[model samples]
Target: MTTFDDREKAFENMFAHDQEMQFRIQARRNRLLGEWAAAKMGLTPEETDAYAKAVVQADFEEAGDEDVIRKLMGDMTQAGIDIDEAGVRAALDEQQVIARRMFIEAQ
Candidate 1:
C-alpha cells in the first residue's frame, strides 16, 4: 500500500482503540461506583456483583451519566442509604478518575 493508505489505516486503528478504551473505562467506573454504593447499602458479595453488573448495563440506557445517577439515587433512597445526588455524582467522578488511572496503568 501507499504511504497515505498506511497512514489512513493507522489513524483508523487509533480511533477504534480509543473508542474501545473509553467504553472499557466507563464500564469499569460504573462497576466501581456500583460496588461502592452496594457496600454502603449493606449488600452481600453476590448481590454486590449483580448490582455492579446492573450499574454497568444501566450506563447503556442513555448517552450520558444521568441514567446511572438516577438508578443509583433511586436504589440508594429505597435502601435507606443517606446519599444525595451530589454524593453520587462525586463518587461517579472519583470512579472515573480511578478508572482512567487503572486503564492507563494497564497499558
Candidate 2:
C-alpha cells in the first residue's frame, strides 16, 4: 500500500478504537447511575441488577443521553421518589467520572 493508504487505514483504526472506548464509558456510566438510583428507590439487589441492565439498554433509544435521562426520571417518578431530570443529569455527570476512572483502571 501507498503511504497515503497506510495513513488512512491508521486513522480509521484509531477512530474505531475511540468509538468503542466511548461506548464502554457511556455504558459504565449508565450502570453506575442505575445502581445509585436503585439504592435511592430502595430496590432489592436482584432488582438493582435488572434495573442497571435496563438503563444500559435505554441508551439505545436515542443518539444522546436524553433517552437514559428520560427513563430514569420516569422510573423515579413512578416510584414516588420525587426526583427531577436535573437531578438525574447531575448523577449522570458524576457517574461519567467514575466510569472513566474504572475504564482507565481496567486498561
Evaluated with lDDT, which candidate comes out highest?
Answer: 1
Clashing pairs for model 1 are none
Candidate 1 lDDT trough over 10 residues, lowest sum: 1-10
Error of 2 at 76 (Å): 0.4
Give all candidate RMSDs, comma-separated: 1.2, 0.9
| Per-residue alpha-carbon lDDT of candidate 2 for residues 17-96, written as tens digits (9 for 90 to 100) | 99999999999999999999999999999999999999999999989999999999999999999988889999999999
Give per-residue CA lDDT, model 1, range 1-107, as digits (tens): 69999999999999999999999999999999999999999999999999999999999999999999999999999999888999999999999999999999999
- Which regions of candidate 1 fall more than 4 Å away from where they truly are? none
* Candidate No. with top TM-score: 2
In candidate 2, which residue pairs clash? none
